[model samples]
Target: MPWYAPRHLEEALALLAERPGLIPIAGGTDVMVDGNAGAAGREYLSLAGVANLRGVSETPLGLAIGALTTMTEIGRHPLVCRHLPALAASARVTGAVAIQNRATLGGNIMNASPAADNPPVLLAYGASVVLMSAMGSRHVPYAQFHSGYKETIRRPTEILGEVIVPFPPDHAHHYFRKVGTRRAQAISKVGLAAVLAGRPGSWECVRFGLASVAATPILACALAAAITGSDHSVPRDEELAEALGRDIAARDDIRSTADYRRRVAINLVREALAPWRSQGGFDASH
Candidate 1:
């Protein structure tokens, strides 16, 4: 198979327009895995040489993280840790240190796996993705980007350029956790990334993004609504369980059963909101 490494974004866009089946590969972590499993393309468009697509920068909206920015960079970047702590936490738990060094955020997203780590955080943060083609660029809300399992709205001529993430509101409670066989390297059986805003009993935002329990990573809108609508600081387990039934489409898979995933997901949601239930709200000092 032939590989083309384009040093510029324009050159890469040109190649995509000219070549019919060229797969854009940034970190090549997922691409190499696919190749090893005999499910890769005949040719690949290597974006590793595209220097423009590899850093995090400030934008008017908030932060513009280049598509090729590695997990290692995101995990430790001061801006990410300070502004989007949940994202930084997610990046830290993505695979192992070696994989984190090689896995790009764009690659993690474009791979379209329900078990992917960072996407849930992106969803919880209300992030948007920039897709660029030779024609121009367009921004798609991350929530609407995925069409189905292993599928995305990106056109063949377009490449993911960057991700735009707005800062969360003041005093927001950020929670991120992944339930896997092991702590570090194992794929998530159920992963959650959430941001809770506002005071107890009178909630504002309850954004919860869940993984490995649906066809694609999804925001648990139904469950969030149940929590916000509740009279108590947090909704009861029974109410949460019912709401979760509508939010996730868990299926029995090799890693875990549908019932087990659903149970764990609900438990995680309760555990995340324990502070709100015990105390009036989460303490910002911590």
Candidate 2:
């Protein structure tokens, strides 16, 4: 198996164009695992030498996170922590310290696992992925990027460049929760990310994202709308929980049953929403 390590984006694209089957390797975390199991075979195109595809930078619109940025970098980035705490939280929960240091954001997305932590947070943040190919470049919304399990919109000749997370003004509150066999180094049975804006007096806007409960990481618009329109002061906790459970289409899996996951998701949402209620309204600082 041959490996090509190009130093520039254009050179990398040229190599990809020349060999369409060349798998792009960033952190090599997932690739090594799959390769060991004879899943990805031996040939690969290493992105390590691609200087352009690393680091997290601030853009005029928001933030541009390069594909090679490690999970550890995302977890520790002050901008990420301040702007998208849910993303930071998710990054912190991905594997352990050693894995976090080597697992790249692009690898996580390209893996397309239902339990991948970053997708839900990205969906909640309304992020978009920048993909480049010999043909050109295009942006795909995070919600639309994943087609199904182990599948994405990326083409054979394309590589994920960066993730663009738009800035949100006004008061914003984010909540993230995950359930698994144990706390550390465990794959999620279910995970959720929620973002709410506006004062508690009025639920102006809301976004909900979830993983391991659907075909792909999803934005629960119906659930968000339902919560936003309802009376904030009403003590209908059980009803709200029930509503969220109904909106999620969880299915049975080896890790757990669909009913259990749905119930847990409902409880998690209720707990996540509790903070806003306690403040008498949403706090801008929180």
TM-score of each: 0.95, 0.91
lDDT of 2 by residue, 119-193 (tens): 988888889999998889999888899887788989999999999998755577788988999999998999999
TM for candidate 1 is 0.95
For residue 140, give model 1's deviation from the true position in Å: 0.4
| CA deviation > 4 Å runs, candidate 1 | 35-41, 200-202, 282-286
Q: For residues 1-286, write the lDDT of model 1, one tens digit per residue.
A: 6789988889999999999578888888888777353354477899999978888988889899999999999999999998899999999999999999989999999999999998999998999999999999999999999999999999999999999999887788899999999998999999999888766565666799999999999999999888878765566789899999999999998999999999999998988787777666654643
Q: Give me the runs in candidate 2 sitting further than 4 Å from their true place.
A: 35-42, 200-204, 231-235, 238-247, 283-286
The CA lDDT at 254 in model 1 is: 94
lDDT of 2 at 48: 85
